[model samples]
Target: MVNFDDKRNFYRMLLNSEVKVTIIDDEINSEFVATCRDLSATGMAIEMSHPLEMGTRVKAKIESANASVQALDVKGKVVRIEEEATDLYLVGIAIDDMD
Candidate 1:
């Protein structure tokens, strides 16, 4: 028997907080709110009302409630999208640049 587990280098932190997402396409910019499900050093998972197209560029911001923890702001690309419900979608994004 073999044990299986997450293969990523960074462990994912479970987060149930609001995330602000900004889509960057050419000169058009659009913003929306989503719920962040998990976060890691390399990527994050978010749940939103609508699905984003694969390979779309976006910027995500997650503000920390605790003063000790710093807020996360990163530019990433949409890697995957899955429909969870009739109007709900789960989106995966790979972190490209962080601020």
Candidate 2:
């Protein structure tokens, strides 16, 4: 059998860490706690209790356990969402900018 590698441009890093997600809209700025499942240079997958609408702008932050390491902070938009279970959703975000 021929072996095939992932076709993604960037490699994904699997994670099970808490992520702070903030929805930034013209009228509302709500923050929520979610779990980051996987991350790549351009995108990330997160599991949250509620589903986010597609194209909703958001900011995500992940703090590092080590003091020496910097936290991951990025601004992105919701690109995909899937129902993983009742009251649970897997959301995919397309990273736009990083801080």
TM-score of each: 0.90, 0.92
Alpha carbon lDDT at 55, candidate 1: 96
Candidate 1 residue-wise lDDT, 8-99, digit = tens = 78888888999999999657689999999998899999999999999999999999999999999999999999999999999999998999
The list of candidate 1 runs beyond 4 A from truth reads: 1-4
Task: Give the candidate number with the greatest lDDT.
Answer: 2
Report lDDT (Cα) of residue 38, candidate 2. 94
Worst 10 residues of 1 by lDDT: 1-10
Tens-digit lDDT string for candidate 2 (41-79): 999999999998899999999999999999999999999
Candidate 2 C-alpha RMSD relative to the actual structure? 2.9
Clash totals for all candidate models = 0, 0
lDDT at position 64, candidate 1? 90
Q: State the local distance difference test value for candidate 1.
A: 0.92
